[model samples]
Target: MADLGHSSDDTSVDSREENSSQDSKPEFSEDEETLISRMYNLVGQRWSLIAGRIPGRTAEEIEKYWTSRYSTTTE
Candidate 1:
């Protein structure tokens, strides 16, 4: 028999880490914001399309960002 690097603690801890990561919000840099704005003007509100240009970003997150950043009344 061999240890094979197996451990009960590994599986249990990994599941918790995955769940916590999903709950965390995405972070964007200043450069990313500028790029997003430029891309929006060029491509319009196609979130999935826009997301494809920005690596590691999803359509859902981009939509949320667009709404919060540019879709508000801001009165």
Candidate 2:
């Protein structure tokens, strides 16, 4: 058999881990949502800056949230 980076079982385990961690992340407040929106618009998906502007959120979280909420698969 040809080598693949991960086995099917490994893929499934990774997917579950990702989903569980995502589920544990708290929802953004209305003000934080607004800030995210504004920062996104002003900087065009520059998530590090957006995360810097927000008090508690991490850049990775901000990037994921923006991608999930605003970006289409085509983009």
Candidate 3:
């Protein structure tokens, strides 16, 4: 068998750990949600700026929220 440069056991374990961690992703509080909306309106997708205003949140998280909350579904 050819080595695929990756181990199946390690990959499965890593993915399981990541999935568990993500399953407990913290929710955005009402105030944080409001702040994100206002910031997005003012900054126009500047996620880092929004994240800076909200403590304990990251730019990627803000962006994901915005996308999920506001983005229209296109088939």
Estimate TM-scores for all models: 0.61, 0.61, 0.67
TM-score winner, 2 or 3: 3
lDDT per residue (tens digit) for residues 4-58 in model 2: 6458768989998788667735468889989999888899867888999998788
Query: Clash pairs of candidate 3?
Result: none
lDDT (0 to 1) per candidate: 0.79, 0.79, 0.83
The segments of candidate 3 whose C-alpha lies over 4 angstroms from its true place after superposition are 1-21, 24-26
Q: Specify the highest-lDDT model's number.
A: 3
Write the number of the candidate with greater TM-score, choosing between 1 and 2. Answer: 1
Q: Which is the winner by lDDT between candidate 2 and candidate 3?
A: 3
lDDT of 3 by residue, 1-75 (tens): 335545777788899878854853447899999999998889998999999999888898888888877889998
TM-score of 3: 0.67
| Model 2 quality (TM-score) | 0.61
Better by TM-score, candidate 3 or 1: 3
State how far residue 62 of model 2 sits from its true place (Å).
0.5
Candidate 2 Cα RMSD (Å) = 9.2
Query: RMSD in angstroms, all models?
Result: 4.0, 9.2, 7.2
Task: Tally clashes: model 2.
Answer: 0
